[model samples]
Target: MASPRALPTPISATSFFQSKPTAHSLNSSSVSKNLSFWRNGSGLLQLITLGSTRSRSNAVENSSPTQFSSESSQISDVPILSCSEATEKLRTTRETYESKQQYLAMYSSIFGGITTDPAAMVIPMDDHMVHRGHGVFDTAAIMDGYLYELDQHLDRFLGSAAMAKIKLPFDRETMRRILIQTVSASKCRKGSLRYWLSAGPGDFQLSPSGCHKASLYAIVIQDLSPSDNKGIKVITSSVQIKPPQFAVMKSVNYLPNALSKMEAEENDSYAAIWLDEDGYIAEGPNMNVAFVTKEKELLMPRFDKILSGCTAKRVLVLAEGLVKEGKLRGTRVGDLTVEEGKKADEMMLIGSGVLVRPVVQWDDQIIGDGKEGPVTQSLLNLILEDMKSGPATVRVPVPY
Candidate 1:
């Protein structure tokens, strides 16, 4: 190997770093030579030179073995590209090599832009929602070119945004039209539609006052795994539920809910259900809990301290027919005890993603003869029927 100059000494904040890493100036010849050296295998050379500039989180990976040992003159081997040169290099490389996996249409209100190009679904780093959890979001299912309960979900989405103190970028009707337009642009028939109301991008600060305005974004997702109506098991969650004010807001602050779900999966259950501080059955991480009493009454926990679930509310409404038919004597909401829930004739979880799911077991105890009970399945069929051929009051057809 050819010999090279000694490496530049490490620069501390008070030392040559106060100026630049290359405090030692080079002649035109040396600069040309350095630039040439950086053209190939220069990633390693810049590692030491730019170490102080990059924070610890900028983790770079180099799977291939290094060509030279530490004894090599890294400073001499590294090239120093001018601003223009670096920009051109990066732009060319990014154009040729950097690409994202394909996605359906996405709409962003920041620039009032909607595009199918996955590359265009970008957000600024300074968004308060990105840094300070100052945003709210909601999703509605798309089936056979119909938007399922979009109005209800949007109502909740707006409600959450209000609770988060994030104002809508547009009026309610305009927002609804935009949502439908976004979904229609995606041209997806069987998938999901997820959208967000963000405290718009601005200075990275604790308060969102600096934000220009709130923004809305929407995207389409393909949910191939339709609800199978299979029975699943759940356990009482140990994670603490959020206070009523924050809990009802469906904001992006979901760490606790996520942990609760993980806790259930870790324990070999389908989902985790939380309990109030007083030990009343609260709700699941992302769903609601309901039960068919031995006396044939359908009961659910009050929405006072939880996110008022859209799907749960719809189930309650749809279950009214069962009430008139004498299948369910009545349907109502109240504080439910865990002990009462474990002894119910049937239990089911309700959510938009899962229309209705039978709960056969809770912890180690069997729920109602250890089988998916009749009422649970009946309600599941009802929800499914509403989805496929429900009245226009519940389904919104996509223009595409």
Candidate 2:
């Protein structure tokens, strides 16, 4: 893996303040004070009353209705509500506010003062991994208010950290507690959680010994909607994956993966499939690639260059049934040519985001009938069923 780059700058959530204040009294000192406080704080006071009717009535009478309407109009532009929909608008606003507050509370509870932003939490740069890209991360889906495969994901994360010589700040059980607390606090029962660790900030040198501390963080993101599962096109990239010395470890250094993804995006494809230095098939930028032969064998590239994907492992387990029934055969990683993939009976990319989406096209060549093939469809169904039931114990479930 390449050395880690400077962490990306954090993104803010200030767009929520686009709404203007609604029509309310500001003539009296109390009303003015409330308005001022709202402007500085949450601006809730602007939508509510805080004083006696006499004061409010006096402020309303003295205030221009036109001005109130104009202010209300500006606030109405928020797209959340209109003056005619004040009651509903207020309710929605409160709900949104409460949700954000809950998310923050959860983050604080998990990592203490280490972080608070639920979007782009940061670990200091002095950590060894920050300077050397010596840590790992794992993410899993949350559905119906329950975290999915929390334990399995954490196990992978810890293993990667150890591979890079970074120590975990907490044990598996402790980390699980923090993850649950963070997820619950965020009120993100229906989202994805990204749990990552970094060799805590250290000197600017590449040596791992300089890094004494490690940082762990979890981010809860909105879940993928069904609409997002639509199949995507992919293109083969000229870039080759540098075979990892520790192919099974998931590390922070991902420039090669990022570059491959950028190539796919630039070409308007869903993903980029890479080749190895030997001109054999490797994998997608962030997923495992699989193809079904004319003989109905399920073949995957050996773990030579890409990280071993948890989703890919699950799919392999599910394929065992088919293999035993003589419906399919399982083949391990080996050199596979691009021609083989293009001419296969079926092909699909599996990962956390893409799942088991069939490859409708590879570049301009149509894959199979240029639609989802039987093997791809069946595998997708089996994986979905497994996920819905619960984590597959044969497969690891990282608890958080």
* Least accurate 10 contiguous residues by lDDT in model 1: 56-65
**Top lDDT hit:** 1
Backbone clash numbers for all candidates listed: 0, 15
lDDT of 1 by residue, 55-96 (tens): 421321221123222212353445545434544665565568
TM-score of 1: 0.77
Using TM-score as the measure, the top candidate is 1
lDDT of 2 by residue, 257-306 (tens): 89989999999998999887777777888889999887788888887466
* C-alpha RMSD in Å of predicted model 2 compared with the true structure: 13.8
Q: After superposition, how far is residue 347 of candidate 2 from its true place, in Å?
A: 0.7
For model 1, how many clashes? 0
User: Which whole-number lDDT from 0 to 100 does residue 134 have in model 1?
Assistant: 89
